[model samples]
Target: MGSFQIEGGHRLSGSIQPQGAKNEALQILCAVLLTSEKITINNIPDILDVNKLIRLLTNLGVKVEKTGKGSYTFKSDDLDLDYLHSEQFKIDGSGLRGSIMIVGPLLARFGKGYIPRPGGDKIGRRRLDTHFEGFIKLGAKFRYNKEDRFYGVEAPKDGLKGSYMLLEEASVTGTANIIMAAVLAKGTTTIYNAACEPYLQQLCQMLNSMGAKIGGVGSNLLTIEGVEELKGCEHRILPDMVEIGSWIGLAAMTRSEVTIKNVNWNMLGVIPNTFRKLGITIEQQGDDIHIPAHTNGYEVQSFIDGSIMNISDAPWPGFTPDLLSIMLVVATQARGSVLIHQKMFESRLFFVDKLIDMGAKIILCDPHRATVIGHDFKSTLKATTMSSPDIRAGISLLIAALSAKGTSVIHNIEQIDRGYENIDERLKAIGAKIERIA
Candidate 1:
């Protein structure tokens, strides 16, 4: 396992560009299997998870070519359907959670799709029932091999027939998977209570451009009319909003002046304003976000009734759960206390013990919530060695280390690399003292 050696108490300046959206890239990559024509994708982040999915596609006989840095052209003219049942595929497909998405496209275009139980962050129980359930609603037969922990879905002899589905929960990945499958069904498919995140909207728009008929691009109700076949088109991914939020928190925690370029401001939803609630200054410079140096510590805002401030995650138009770890870390040095409620995942707040060891005052009320008492920068966190548990927690720990007193070592940094692209180099460009130790 590789580690990161970080020298703390350094202020970072200059500008950093967020990489292509990791979540969107996963969905878009899977959509390439929906068509056999040449599909060119730009702004593909060179991260471990995305790369793993690309390799999985390559092994399945999709022709992939590198056109430029962060750009690739893929053609699914030929595919090895038997590879889906191979032992090698079982091992490769189980490496990342994104591999589950490929099943939808394969079942839609071809007749069958199979996948091993996917593996990802150990944050909590991430069920695959939503994806499989959606596939079943689209007239596909589902089966599970408990002994092998594998899932298989096959379309009917007449192929997939569109139907209306009201999801029990608004899941982003589940919605994307069902949308891909429905695009090639026999009739109209209506999905209610769907996730309307910008990335999902991008997926729908890309499908529309590729000859699919989709309505309600940015709403909870999506209507997809089945097309005989889909053609290929060029698509560019948006900047990762989660990474942009992380940079915002990093700037405030270390008292640095950093500018995040080409952030696609309108699509950021409540991210910028949510940071503002923590008393951080976020300036919009055209399409970029400029966070000036917080020479004095920031203060948390209270409710209109003078109650303590509380930040929680919800569906779209609400604060994202991905950045809650960053918010918890940033609140350590703020001027007042704020409550962080992580509603989606249970184990995400377990990393607070490491921060508490670093001299931050945080009360882990339970698996779902924590109250962070800010030191207001009067006390600096003392550096310590730690291990990264997941992607978001890893970056949060790295931010904490960068703002601490001495040097710190983070083991199992592969968790971080799975998401961020060249994170150490990118931080170095903004004057952050981080080194990757192999």
Candidate 2:
């Protein structure tokens, strides 16, 4: 068990480079099982969840070699399809939701795949219905056995054939799974209402680099031209968008002047404008976002039409639901009030009680909405021991501690370690007084 002891009231200063996208890394790592040759993945995040997924891959006899820092070569020339029947495989796959992704490629190559229920941030109801349905559309049979909550999939007609799939939601993992399976299908595959997140974009680009034909790279509609086989190729991951959002919130809350380099600006379309509503000053220098220190804190702004401002998360080109927790904390320091709506995840807004404990005014309307009133920050936040609920909330709590007045202790940091790499070390490098303790 590791914890962080952070002293508040310090401005974090420095130029920091964002790591490879954790979301993308997980998706791409699972995509490796689709091919049998050496597939080089560059800019992979060296984080716990990623390492855990890598361990699972190696356990199945996949050849994995570290090529460089945040880079690796994965060869799936040898994989035990029956590895899923092992108790150890069940344990590892059930520990993370990304494991569900292995089903698509496995079924595509072997015509049969079995996996236990996947796990991830218990933020809300994350469904695998879309994933199963997508596979079904591509000619796969599913057996949902409640006794073990396991999913067993088998293709009836040789294997999955590319077909038009209209998804209910633009699920990132679901889209990735379909794309991987579709690449080896027999005809043109059109995915409607597909998740066009930057991570998915990177996945498509990588698939295209490997000789898979994909059109509409950054849109909700994707056209994948099925090929007999996808050859291996080198692909570099993109910078972490959620990490950039976290750092942006940290700079706003701690009044720090920090520069986030190579942020992939256009990818952050509404994120900047969304934060700007809280009166946070952000400078766009080419691909970097510069946040200046403002001890007084940013001011929360309402809509130009003067309606009570609401920040909600949608599929894409919308405020991401993942960052809603951090935005809630930022709104606490702003001068005005706003309603943070999390439509995608039901339990995501549940973390506001911690902020309320820290002297922020917040009303939890329900599991989906919360009203946050700026505290004016006249009183100092007295640190208390806290536990992390999920990856995003864990980091949000850390940011709250960073803006608090005294020493704060946060436990169960392994949850945080799953996504962010060496967070305490990274904060320390930026002049933050944070120490890790056992």
* Model 1 lDDT tens row, 269-368: 9999999999999999999999999999899999999988999999897788999999999999999999999999889999999999999999999999
Give candidates' CA RMSD values in order. Answer: 0.6, 1.2
- Once fitted onto the true fold, the runs of candidate 1 whose alpha carbons sit more than 4 angstroms away are none
Candidate 1, run of 10 with poorest lDDT: 125-134
In model 2, which residue pairs have backbone atoms overlapping below 3 Å?
A: 97-119
Instruction: Look at candidate 1 and give me any clashing residue pairs.
Output: none
lDDT of 2 by residue, 108-186 (tens): 7778788899888888778888888998898888898798878988987666788998999899999999888788888
TM-score for model 2? 0.97
